[model samples]
Target: MLVYVVATALAVLFTYISVVYDKTLKDSLQKSRYVYLKPRIDVWQKLTLYVLRVASVLPLVLVAGFRYKVGTDWGNYLRSFRSVTHGKDGHYGEKGYRFIQKFVAFFTSNYIWLFLLCAIIFAGFYFVGIYKMSINPPLSVALIVATSIYFSFLNGMRQGLAQAILFFSLRYVFKRDWKRFLIFVLLASSFHKSSLVFLIVYILYGFKIDIKRIIFYIVIFGMVGLAGGQLVKYVVMKTKYAHYYMSAFADGGFEWLWFFISTAILVVMCCYYENGQKSELKGQFNVLLWMQMISVIFCLISATVPESNRIVWMFNIGQILSLPILISLEKDKRWRLVLLVLILGFYMLATYIAIRGGSHRVLPYRMSFGGE
Candidate 1:
């Protein structure tokens, strides 16, 4: 637990430095009259950004990659890796992850290679996604880490990978490049079949959400929740998850914390929209609002369908990015600080609850490189 706390704090601190230094470098370049010095400035900027990016994620990658008998599914993933090495068919996870396992096993039977590869992909996409799309990358990184998305990666590697890909693919959604967006969604689903739910994101991309539409969507999805169990069960029975149908049909407890957090983020977004800060990114903001609302709806559905919360994870990227952007949108300095402290405090408290409550068994951190 101390390890996680220290690592996360260091990650956020490095990210803060990276964001601030990047701006400083840009300003320095603009103020310089030396034409020949522009090339040097650009090189320095790139090098610093790259170095800090690696620094921010390095601790997490090392912790996750070297972990042994950690994470609830640690043994399960090990067995799967060994299974792939032995030329047996996959008995767990989706085809894409299994294919990668087989490809790695062809070169070496060591499960460390597979685990390390997954750790890199998970951390890489998470950092790159925020760096590319967020208006305030430091706050974005802090919020995402605090929300437990980063820690959950250790427990659900396949779903974590899928969610990472989907989060990074938000670039295409913001750009309105449907071809690229669809391609990435398909890739994510190949890692975890549950990721197919993200296809609905492209449909929601064009919507301009207002209070009335928000209420309408809530009511409609609320009705879906009333029968979500049977609907989800019927769908699971037709898929590879059929064996888990009984469990899926059982009621999954409501994720009240996430629901409240997302609702708070959505309210902030609505305030930003009402204030009429109509930048070119406003369209993207609208898309994120729709996604955040959908995240809340999935949380509601989880009251009946046990598996629907994974869909909430898919939409979490929206809330993660939206809050930081809203912070950037706030023109008043005092209000901005207040909003930042409130949101950060909320998410950090969530992290505290998760760690103390032992969600995912991510306590008493352990590490090992040797195999069974």
Candidate 2:
């Protein structure tokens, strides 16, 4: 627990310093040819940013990759790695991840290499995405730590890698480049079938939302929720690739009150931002708002169908960017600081509950390096 706290603090501090230096460079270069040619940073700033980036990424990689008997899926992943090493079939149609495991197993029998490679991929894409899309990079990194989405890197390895890759699609999304966006979506889906649902984000990117559409979606989601596990059961039964997850219906006790509260907060934030700001990032906010709404619907459905939360998680990942973007929308310095404090406070509370919560399966951290 102390280790986790220290790692989290160091991540926030390094990322904050990096963002501060980056913003200074951007601000100073506004009128220079360097701004138009490239984001020219002085040698010192470049070195500082690179060091900070490493500081921000290394601990997460170490913790996620070296952990032993940690995370709910640790045993499952270990079995799969061993199976692949023995030339046996593993993974349920997630060929991309299976191939990675097999390739790593060829070089080393230990599954630690698999975890390390996945962590590198996850961190590379995740950090680059946050750097590219966020108006406030430090806040975005803090949110990831606070929300404990980092746990997904340690547990849901396949989905974590897929989600990180999908994060890159946001660039194509805002540019309206359908071909590029679809390519990334398809690639992500190859890692985790659930990621296929994120393809809808391309369509929702530029969609104009109004009261009527909101009400219509709410009604549709309500109807699906009322169907309980039946709807999800039917879908799973029909989809050959997902049939393995059919047993998830046996325990239909997904609680989504937290998601509901989060959705309400997002709705209010979006409304406030739309009424006030005319920033370039408004389009990005719109895309995030629509995704959040979709996430809310999935969360509602998950209340009845436990397996639906996988889909909810895919969409909820947007909050890493959305929440920070929302906070950045505040123009007044005082109000912005206030909002930042409130957000950090709420996230800290959420992180505490997550670590203590049964479903998160993230407590009592154990590492292979420690002889666990």
lDDT of 1 by residue, 208-272 (tens): 56665786888797787767678767887898667665663354578888888877887777778
Residue pairs whose backbone atoms clash in candidate 1 = none
- State the lDDT at 52 in candidate 2: 80
For each candidate, what is the lDDT?
0.80, 0.75
Which candidate leads in TM-score? 1
RMSD to truth, every model: 2.3, 3.2
Candidate 2 residue lDDT tens string, 240-304: 63644556444656545447456665666656655424767777777888777777777766656
lDDT value, residue 261 of candidate 1: 86
- The CA lDDT at 43 in model 1 is 71
199, model 1: CA deviation in Å?
Answer: 2.3
| Model 1: lDDT to the true structure | 0.80
Report the C-alpha displacement of residue 246, candidate 2, in angstroms.
6.2
Model 1 misplacement above 4 A: 33-45, 248-251
